[model samples]
Target chain A: MIVAANPIGQAITWINDPLNWTNPGGMLDRLGEHLTISALAVALGCLVAWPLGLWLGHLGRGGGLVVLISNATLAIPTLALLTILPVVFASGFGKTPVVVALAVFAVPPLLANAYTGVRQADPEARDAARGMGLSSAQLLRRVELPLAVPYLAAGFRTAAVQVIATAALASFVNGGGLGQIIRTGFGIGIAAGGGQIVAGGVLVAGLALLAEVVLGGVERLVTPKPLRRGRQRLGRPRAADATGSA
Target chain B: MSFRLSYLADPGNPWFSWQYVRDNSDTILAAVREHASLTGRAVVIAVLIALPLSVLAYWFRPLAGPILAVSGVVYTIPSLALFAFIAPYLGTGATTVLVGLVLYALLLIVRNVVAGLNQVPPEVREAAEGMGYGRWRRLFRIDLPLALPGIVTGVRLATVSTVALVTVGVLVGHGGLGQLIFAGFQNNLYKAEIMTAALLCVALAVVLDLLLILVARLVTPWSPRRAR
Candidate 1:
């Protein structure tokens, strides 16, 4: 039976552990590797999902099927996929498999959000673009895409969070990351108490919070100012109309 | 079942025999049943806890942001790690799994609850107040009804997430569809195990999705048919 040690104490002990301090660079390197894997997975997922989402949104056909498949993919549990993939491909233990698994997991939100965002773009604006002799590509690039940016960014935010969180699960299959610290902390000798466990939990939780803050910052930076200004303008007109009618 | 030439042709191969598949049917059925019951319990517990918490969070706007943030942080923890982390405190049982699932659902439910409450037109609230309805009466009789659609949507999303997350319960030796998945990995029966787990999970998700749609229709009879 495990003893219940104070988490704060354990965290202190973990921080003071000579081994962790000695190879602080190693820990940072591992964190970098984890980030690299997560970033690549998101990038690849965006590359594939963005086009599909755009096409699906534009056509408004095949959306049911696309949504079904994407939702199904989302429902596919990470651990289950991790367990199954390694068998089909023998090389599933390391970074490659982890990246692929994460990418698959990441695609659904990106696809769904992008599709919804594009479809939700102002129809009048789209029509105006077309009436101005803008090509389909130009319409998408300048009108629909820009308007859809916030929604797409929201999707990316979700994907980024999920990827960072699930990356820890990769350690179960010996895929290295901050998860290594977690697994090692848990797998230590039988007398192990709350300290190491809490420490590990803190590490993972810390990483998750870090990812959210960083991605949230990126989202704010990338979102166009004109969109916010337009929304504000729209809101004011609506409120005024409501007041006038009232 | 009738024996075929193909069966006889590969008599030496274990997989070629109908007996092999037949022999495993009972085990598979038992596993499936066990998984269903565990998942059902987890989801029920999650809804029960999340619904009230969501309502409370909605009522207290000052607390909404922090509550939602905390839940979001909880949501972002890897399911397995979360389960493992809590297993020690709660012990490895359905109770622990239930708590974890409930915590996960909080993020989605609280946001939806708040959104739904906020979506209630200020005029409606003012009209209710002007008509002398009390806070609880207005909330239940007017606000909640209007917010039903959004709340239902949130529940649907939470249902899907809860279903997916329950698979991690298997790691702590609790029975679920994850059992098939883990077994598949260990025994190298990839197709049998993975296919079963994937199909079951997807089917559960679809079923929940449809069930929630029906519930929404029933609850909000006058609601527009627009999809969010």
Candidate 2:
């Protein structure tokens, strides 16, 4: 009987409803809030994960340790991380605990991919750049970094998708996002709440897919010619990102 | 099973202490057990199916991209939504969670397995083939062992991520540590249960992942550590 309020149908209803288009609690506002949260958190995550991974990858030391560490990061539950962070750091950055939690969640894949991307760069090319009298910075910029661009973008793609999907959890902690609809809808009754939850799920999933498609496109644009034939190369960057669990 | 009278006597200490955890050992252990069984079963089942199919898929290069794309898209679905979507049909039980986990895992597991298979040194396969080793014999003796480190790496990633994802099952009442985390949050932020669950879940993930790595090392002694 309740299947009529099918998740897909419910999603369409929620999307079509004009009421949601208007106010503080409207779909647009929550979408904006969700995007802002994910954007800020991903930015913070890259700031930390990118430089550290870049340094580690460039030095060619601790490669095993870095991958091991990043791999292990996938094991800790994000919900647990989100909850534990607030209690552990009860003082600093009082207003945006969710951002901090999400940033932590977003770090592993970005770090893992950035390191692997740079570390995996063509060694011969790296040496050639060096032999040509390029400074350390120039070698990194002109050769290694460019080659690693696909991976860096891959990291961004994975991190962005994850942060956006997980950001829905913020509503549980009184933070703003589309999850608010799902949470409130559940309390109201299935026909309404259930439908809303379905719709909200669609929104989150849609956003994640959008991120994947967009980033995958960007990754393709930056990839060098020969590497394109080995589409399998895209697999490594993406594989680590998937290691970041729900 | 028993509460410490002295700890209870002090009403002023509002947060969780070691005593509180000691008192609730039975419930906590049960939840952990439930979580392990659900997640463990999903992984075991997935590897069994994925291993064979992926090996074939690797052999048949034409099918690789399409199959992987379908599975990858499945992974893109958010867990909660996937759970909800399936719940109505599956009737909201442990079975439903398994269905979701298995589907989510298929892509990650299958893709990694295929990737691992593909990475096996071509010469080793050629050598085995030249020896007139039967296909099955070659797969078991040469290709599999050589390809194992990669396969095991994929398994490690899949298992670890699966364990972490099991926590989301708290959305219903089935998730093991997830239930503790959810209950603690709902009950006025009972710090002890929340902290215990958090620490325990993390410990479980790290330990399981490390255990897999150690196993991988033991199995692939010939493979030197090289990653990019």
Candidate 3:
């Protein structure tokens, strides 16, 4: 294969390339495309998961079915999904297909989290919301949603990481991104050289790290400060209490 | 069904080519054999390293944060990217793949080990020490037993992640079940190849997880009964 050639020398050459650094647009454009695909997938996942999870959590039925399906879906390998999705959709290849495949992969975490978040919402809060002459819709929006933000955000973080990783798999189908560079380099037996492969790998890793940091920050910002403080205070005691009870 | 079979048997159809099957079979088998040996070795090495490292981390609380942070960063990198990054140094073939898998397994195993160690009630450890048990005796007899469940949980997670990450080895032409899936995609033989690989992966994960839970029970009799 391409890697059989002197990989170290090739990698060094790719890394030292003036064109990669000097023509920053190429790299940036690919990064932008990757981010766009990931973001869209995550957004679409949220739309599907939020409603379904809310319904299951509130109604307290079909949860087993939902969980079973989602868990099973989680096991459907990304490459398999990417391969099969195109056959069914006839889109052939591109960002749209990548987003669709990733969205499917992303949905389960959000759905699971949303269900858990809503189900685990303090019953007293729900009762209080009911006693306050609030409508069901109002109770859901004001009490359930606000309470579920942290869990939902946790799910979003999971989705974010999965999307970022799988987004690179899109390169296999000739869909453009850093994966394209990595796959092509490897395909041509140049990946062993370390330059294009390392560069591409670093770029992808950097993107994943950036996503985690940014989204984690957003999660913290959106989560209520009092709730955050409560979590800190409750964390140790709750664990101790749970262990004691057990 | 008979008509479909007849169509498949037709000489005019490309699907009837024995040449395609013959040429790919040797490559596929070799890839599977090599991938399995590499991954198996990697996991064994990782467990040995991680288990000791975890104990040391627990004993030296100050080291935990940095060690965990480094592992966590390693964990976040996609398997393909990680393999690619190491490929230059290790070069291709089994060694590079093994190194990448071991690194990937470390973060999960270490976290579980730490959690397992922490779960040993302080009083239990103190009582063991008070009984004149040396650190080694206490660790092996008391701590390790109690920690088994958590460690097992970590092992289960690592197993699934390892199975998935092993697929990335295909990118370097070190193939396994991923080769089957990839070939299925390449040949457009969707059901026969992709489904077989997918089922095998899921089966491997489930079976291994179940076996670990059994091992945990056998090891830790005092622990609460595991959830079904």
Candidate 4:
């Protein structure tokens, strides 16, 4: 039987072909690579940003500057960052450059959210904790941190989703990921590779949406019980507040 | 750093070269123009589309959640994936990038529009109505004026982000400064070219942001926040 000629048909045929998924540097390998890069970048970002953000928030110092800097960072295009890192590092096409770029992209949401979350914690709770003779560190560990869980979770969700989506660009630098499928398809020429290209796009988009949904659940789950009821009143976390996440 | 054109061809491949800038001034200007135009057009169109939809959502409270949700989902999609998905249908070029950029701008614009509209005091609207102002007139003269600050803020955010995202259009061969950045990366990692393009992008964002802030101030001279 003749393979269907439409792009969607070709994409379906491409996905249906078990050989496509099982082959080396195929969909599964790309998927694994994508996840690894995303995970590493997000972890690194959190390590650097969380402590700084949380400390600043607790101190109520540099909050305005943090917001300004965060906003400025958002204006840096993701593509430019991805391309420039490798040049600055003098590294050839590989995961390191991509990871660093993605990490930079991930920092704003995580840092801003963490800072805002803690700073916006209930003033009464802070007073009570202080009144009860809690130490500074104890106040942070027991009172502020717990209350900041939802914000932290929301920030994590945004970072993860943004990284997962941006990870597709790794292929442009030969960093290898699901983006490789799309890049490879382009190399093969659109006429023959339309299915492959479309398939790659589908996979990346689907994976990003999936991360968003899953992390959204995690964000909900991590909210303290009393806060859960007031979640709507608190307002939805504005993920768009991040620059390149768009 | 030398002004000599030969420095552009120097074997050392330095990351910064004034010679390169002199030689490529036209190309650089063209890229900047393209980047700025794409960003400006996308944001303008997004505001147009977002404003009416925002009004609808505000007037009909039931629609606000879904409107915001859809835009949020669109924003969540990776820029490359969206471009790739649309390329087949639209083919590659400015059109594809413009469409994608506009979609990305919608969430910021819509949210801001809604927020701006919400900031209008109920008493002002009531006062406008008491003066026999028509519904549309009240909205135009009362609601929108008060909402201008928030709307401008949204426009500022969308414009800056779009400036950055315009580089992704290079995926479809339309990424203004992104073209230079990509070309430099491909040409054995030409650091000067990449750095120049990237820096210009950041500079452009800053300039536009400042310009919008100026516009916002001029438009909302009466804002209490401004008085403070």
| Chain A TM-scores in order | 0.84, 0.88, 0.83, 0.92
Candidate 3 regions off by >4 Å?
A1-25, A60-74, A191-193, A229-246, B1-35, B188-191, B224-227
How is the predicted docking of candidate 1 categorized under the CAPRI scheme?
acceptable
Better of 1 and 3 by TM-score: 3
For each candidate in the order shown, give its overall lDDT on alpha carbons.
0.67, 0.75, 0.70, 0.84
Give the per-residue lDDT of model 2 (tens digit) for B1-228.
Answer: 445333323454345678868899999999889888887898888888778878878778888888888887888777776766665445447886888888777777787778778888888889889889998898889777877866886677677778888877765457888888877766655668887887788787777777888888788787688663
What value does the lDDT take at residue B221 in candidate 1?
85
Model 4 pairs whose backbones collide = B169-B175, B170-B175
- Candidate 3, clashing residue pairs? A2-A189, A7-A192, A7-A193, A11-A193, A11-A194, A11-A195
**Poorest lDDT segment (10 consecutive residues) of candidate 1 chain A:** A237-246
| Each model's Cα RMSD | 7.8, 5.4, 6.2, 4.2
Cα shift from native, residue A180, model 4 (Å): 2.0
Q: How many residue pairs clash in model 3?
A: 6
- Give the DockQ ranking, best first: 4, 2, 3, 1
Candidate 3's fnat? 0.31
Q: What DockQ does each candidate score versus the true complex, computed on alpha carbons?
A: 0.26, 0.33, 0.30, 0.42
- Candidate 3, residues B1-228: lDDT per residue as tens digits? 554334223444342244544666775556556545665676678889899989989989999999888987787787668877877666667667778888877877888889999999999999999999999999999898888877887676666556655666777766577777777767644445565565565665566667777877887787677465
Candidate 1 fraction of reference contacts recovered: 0.28
lDDT of model 2 at residue B104?
77
Given candidate 1, what's the lDDT at residue A94? Answer: 56
* Per-residue alpha-carbon lDDT of candidate 1 for residues B13-80, written as tens digits (9 for 90 to 100): 33223453467777667766666665566556666776677677778878777877787667667665
Off by over 4 Å in 4: A1-5, A232-246, B1-11, B224-228
Per-prediction TM-score to the true structure, in the order listed: 0.80, 0.84, 0.84, 0.93
